[model samples]
Target chain A: MSTDTVETIRTTVPVGAQYAPGSLLDWSEALVPGDIVLDERVAPNAPWSAVVRAGDVLTIVDVGGNQSADCLMFNAHDTSERYSVPDTLTWQGNAYVREGTVLRSGLGRPLMTVVGNEIDRQDTIGGACSKESNTLRYGHHTAYQHGCRENFLAEASRHGLTSRDLVSNLNWFMNVPVEADGALGIVDGLSAPGRRVAIRADMDVLVIVSNCPQMNNPCNEFNPTPLRMIVTRNEDTVR
Target chain B: MVGARDTASVLAARADARAQGSNVSDWMPYLPAASSPFAPEGVDPSALVWAETVAPGGYTHKVVARGTRLRLEDVTGDACAHVLVFNALEPWERLNVADTQKIPWQAYLGAGHPLLSGEGRVLATVVADTSAHHDAFCGTSSDEWNVVKYGDAAPQGPSPSGRALLTLAGVKHGLTPRDLPPSVSFFQGVRVEDDGALAWQGSAGPGTYVDLVAEMPLIVLVANVPHPLDPRTDYVVGPLRVHAWRGDPSGPADEHYSASPERERAYLNTTDYLEARGL
Candidate 1:
């Protein structure tokens, strides 16, 4: 047996609430013409990940505005081939992401392209919060509070992920601006309720997300709320 | 199965090359440095494979072949060069320091230690170390950590993050976040107190450096930033200098390669891989 299997058995987390496909999310926020591959509501302060096939559209609905989702992507066939933020910024020449911007992989290829967006922009810098950071930023009392890192740990465990799997993530709906002197400011959010951002996968991409559960920062306004992930195939796909 | 097949085919190719009266790795393409921004004063560029200077809070990723020595220097004191190593051919098989420490019962990694991969392959060996210690536990600084420590005036973006830089570098190498493994923070020291609490300690001064020799073709991801446990009042920032050179030759009798039986096996795996590839 492989060493990875033994390690997985030692660290496997008990499964939590399970929801059927397309059962939790309402289709009102984003329109989907073809068959829905996956749809599930991600509770506030929780993490969820799924495989988004090439040609499929994954719509993330901020059902409650001002919520930031920490997201990461990996090539399904090769987990090592994953997303690159610096390359994305270099390829786009823009600090923030928007419609028409292609999310570049580590190998300088397009993993997904943002085809639709309802918000002004999403932060590529305001990283996801973790327990250690919560204690460092908020206070010692917040150390016990679960952050996106904990959520990712719980969710990624299903796919045999561990500490090595965690990466720098994208903070959707959060407002972080580069200052005049190259300083960064993580402050209030630009998204409100009902904001939806959609992307079309250019390859088989595995996406993991953490619904921001932060209570100390202004990203989520200290009140974490639930959201939905809707994955749909294109009209040309033979689903 | 794929790794085994590739290894076999590579070995066969090496044998074929030997039969042809030429070495397969004689054709390794190494872009020698014409101009390197990181070379120290009076150092000629001809001897260097590549050299690059990284700004404060910057990150970079590059691949180094076996027998390549990576030299990292802090231009100023109080900086950290967080490093992550990954298998260039098979990204899934990467350095696991936890295994490196657990198997050998070592607490700190320096000269004589082998960085092991998940599949028990030797990826690199520490050729030289100037610092008294380097931490394997502390990761990197983040947005909120900066906010709390430096207040709202803290520098933004993923500045001093080991994980973030590694992730960015991994993707650039056709890899992803899950490929980021625990890293080594050069020039940063941690001491476990009597109660088992880790206390920050002093590392090397400016102009000091540590060098590692790659045992396998591997990805080198570095974050030029401050240690997360650094209690400095000012947001610690410093320029970093990186120099790559041709490392000493590899063999079974190498000091690091012969450290232990397990390490010997891992080194053999690397040799099997390199020999088969004709490199």
Candidate 2:
């Protein structure tokens, strides 16, 4: 006689179609590999937004090159089990994340796996945005601007997730070239319009995204462009 | 089960350190600053550089160096550079903004400022300043903090400019959300509308960079750029290099000065103090 309300529901989205603009999706139906979503170029440094469920495909299409998409990720099941770039790299044993790399959770579990790549995928080592970043990086006057954190919390709230669920994420479509002296250089992007990478979920995952509106950084070349996502499920699987 | 085991071990280690007052510094081995795997392909192998570029999202990499100056270049001008620092030997150690703000280190991060460790050691020194000044009051913010500050508001996404420097520093130092302290962002590009209207403007030019000289054997993790957003489903990102770097010529020994446990503890205590005050 547990009085706790355990709500189990299923919502389905078609593949190759645009995600309804400004719509909040249920965690049960959002994140799936092969699902293509799109974001028309946002103003520079605007908050990026998105959501995903377990076992879904997620893709970001760089309609134009040099658009810095400031992004973030978190676990739906447990916020503490956030994304760890070092662990992911150590686990993968490679610096560049391409097809077939598994995204590890904070606890070092496989949250999802990268299954496809249209363009050379970007790095996850870089994290998402926040107001403080906005202010310090930009100027004191820009502190009040909207950012990825706000988008994540907003979508996560619908699914009973909270700040604790917020985790570090991967930066897709960005290009940063490293040098031998251990110095990092933000370079132009390798992604182009219609190019994409796909991810397959490993478990029931709650995925959140912020369409990076950052103008600073060469990853996007300061031009925040729109992106598209497409989600598809395996045939014969009723979701 | 294996993941759980690792989590348990990490939790146990954290708890044990807290209860026994066991210094994590003693357990941590000093590593070369340029020794991280996060270094991108094709750089001077001898130099321990942290990041070559920062992807738009939250990403990190490590660079090991000794006596080498680390540069965070805004390949494009007006790039907001959110940078953090730490002692590589004790990955848990980090820079204390409050202590950093004290006296010589305040308002600007340049030559002569001691980069504090989680254990309160002088990990590095700000040897140069290419930008206007080093930001002491602001550090990288967690998603949770951002939400608390702004309700249902979107963030200014990721900064590709030199944003990766922060990520690389975090990863190299083994820092987690709990370890996040005040960071400094350089070469930001945003347009504020008259009467509070906002416009996105490209602020940085190609090749605007910041340089930092390592004081200890510290790992430099930088996620110069932010991750891309999937408008519908949140994507689980794979490992990608935000930027690449070459190690400094001087070598790891030249960059770091050895320290005692007492000094390490003082450094650690300072970071703790700052966190307690929400700096």
* Top candidate (DockQ): 1
Give the alpha-carbon lDDT of every model. 0.67, 0.46
Please identify model 2 stretches exceeding 4 Å from their true place: A1-53, A134-146, A153-165, A236-239, B1-279
RMSD (Å) of each candidate, 1 decimal: 17.4, 19.9
The alpha-carbon lDDT assigned to residue A68 of candidate 1 equals: 85
- Alpha-carbon shift of residue B187 in model 2 (angstroms): 32
Which stretches of model 1 miss by more than 4 angstroms?
A1-27, A237-239, B1-279
Instruction: Give per-residue CA lDDT, model 2, range A1-239, as digits (tens).
Output: 11123353554521111222332221122233332343233333334444455656665555555454545455655555555543455345444567887776534467777877756656653455445344433444554555555666676677665554454456777654433322233467786655666676576555555566554455555545555555566543223
Error of 2 at B14 (Å): 31
Model 2 alpha-carbon miss at residue A64, Å: 3.2
DockQ for every model comes to: 0.04, 0.01
**True lDDT of residue A147, candidate 1:** 75
As a TM-score, model 2 comes out at 0.42
